[model samples]
Target: MSFLRRLTQAFAPPPRAGLDRHLAMAVLLLEIAAADFSRSEEELGLIRKQLLTGLQLDASSAEALLSRALDRSDAAISMHEFVALLNEELDAAGKRELLSWLWQVALADGRLAPHEEGRIRQLADLLFIPHADFVQTRLAAGA
Candidate 1:
């Protein structure tokens, strides 16, 4: 590598490496939270908890990631790009598990709004999650 190029790379922010998947998952969750046009504290809390637990991230890291993910979700034109990334990165079981977590977020507000339910269903289809498994996850989430 050229010395100047190497120096530039060294001075640049370190790559997040493997965090893209985490951020994509976070974006999906955030998308669901915002789907109803009202984001509840309950849902936000659940999203933070999931980011920390599911991604094994420290609190600060999770917060930072979530903040970035919110921006990405806001700028997103469609969920297809994020869902495509997930499909490439995760196995069937992993995808199913993510769908379950999404359901948990959807149910966090005590009652599921129609828009929330529809968003979940749409995401489930995008992720290639079967309807049976989607229902099973919804039930498991106590929705």
Candidate 2:
């Protein structure tokens, strides 16, 4: 009974108190991963690997989070909710680092589709990241 109660509690959702930054990151990454109009297995692999290594998530946890991210990204009409969540959760430096990661995703296939570039630029601006900084990050990421 105690074990069952603990399991139930563990599965309970977190309170919707404020914007969840992890959810935002997950959504943003999913968008970038799918920016080529079709999601590639290679891109999905990179996303999964990054979430596991960069975010230090276990396999099952990463899979679940990524799945949720994919859903949220699909449902979102604009990037406003994601930007708001990032602003609430991350400082400037953290936001920059996230931009770098997004660029890395853009470069995963050794090419950046125009649509992907456009999406990244829009997201960077929404995150309040300057164009220069965004370009520098992209160049640094070899995008």
Candidate 3:
């Protein structure tokens, strides 16, 4: 590479791996919200709110991320790929926090379906969250 190119590359901002992780997290939240085959406006609102608050993203950025997540979630055949990305990107506490967010999403519509609970349990196991922490997060989310 040329000297100027190398210098410019060195000074350039890092790639948006953090944004990718945020997108993965948003996909998980969307999955939980859609699990019951009932996607309420309240649930979507909560998802946007969580994305804004958790990632400290501006409204536009959150919306874009949500848009991407929605597309990715739709194209996905299983949670395995999303869960794998999350496992690679997040630590234990982060995964637990994600579970908490998921519970919040599940209960956002003021009711929890049986399928939603089952989905949460499945995701928790896939994310390697301890059963105790899963229960605690469920209680914390008032689910």
Candidate 4:
């Protein structure tokens, strides 16, 4: 019974809440991960790893955050909401770091899809990150 309950809880949707900066970033990452019209295991795994490492979340918290990110991603009409939250919350260095994470996700499959590049470009512009930073992150991510 205990194991079953834990398993059930693991699959359950986390409570909906206002989007925090971290969650906003996750939504954007998910968007980038799916930009190529397919969500490869590689992209998905990188996302989880980023959330765990970047956000310093425990496994369960990362899972819950990913759950919420998926719901937000599915229901989103545009990336504006997430972008706006990040714009308000992140500094220049923070934006650069976020872009690096996005680049990492975009390159997870060992290639950069055109759509993924487009999405990342749009996000960088929206985040007010300079072109140099964008290019630098892309290059650093192994292109």
Better of 2 and 4 by lDDT: 4
Q: Tens digits of per-residue lDDT for model 1 on 56-118? A: 999999999989998888887877778888988999899988998888888889888899899
lDDT of 2 by residue, 14-129 (tens): 44443377778878887887888877777788888888988899999999888888877887787777777798788988889889888888778778999889999989988888
Ten residues in sequence with the least summed lDDT for candidate 3: 12-21
lDDT of 3 by residue, 1-143 (tens): 99999999999854544446888899999999999997899999999999999989999999999999998889778777678778899999999889999999999999999999999999999999999999999999887
* Model 4 whole-model lDDT (C-alpha atoms): 0.92
Q: What are the runs in model 4 whose C-alpha is more than 4 Å off? A: 1-17
- TM per candidate comes to 0.85, 0.82, 0.85, 0.87
What is the Å distance of residue 44 in model 3 from its true position? 0.4
Candidate 4's residue-wise lDDT over 94-117, tens digit each?
999999999999999999999999
Of 2 and 4, the candidate ahead on TM-score is: 4
Superposition TM-score, candidate 1 onto the true structure:
0.85
Give the candidate number with the greatest TM-score: 4
> How high is the lDDT of residue 131 in model 4?
98
Q: Which of the numbered candidates is closest to the native, going by highest lDDT?
A: 4
Ranking by lDDT: 4, 3, 1, 2
Stretches off by above 4 angstroms in model 3 are: 1-19
Report residue 134 deviation for candidate 4 (angstroms): 0.7
What is the RMSD, in Å, between candidate 1 and the native fold over all Cα?
A: 6.5
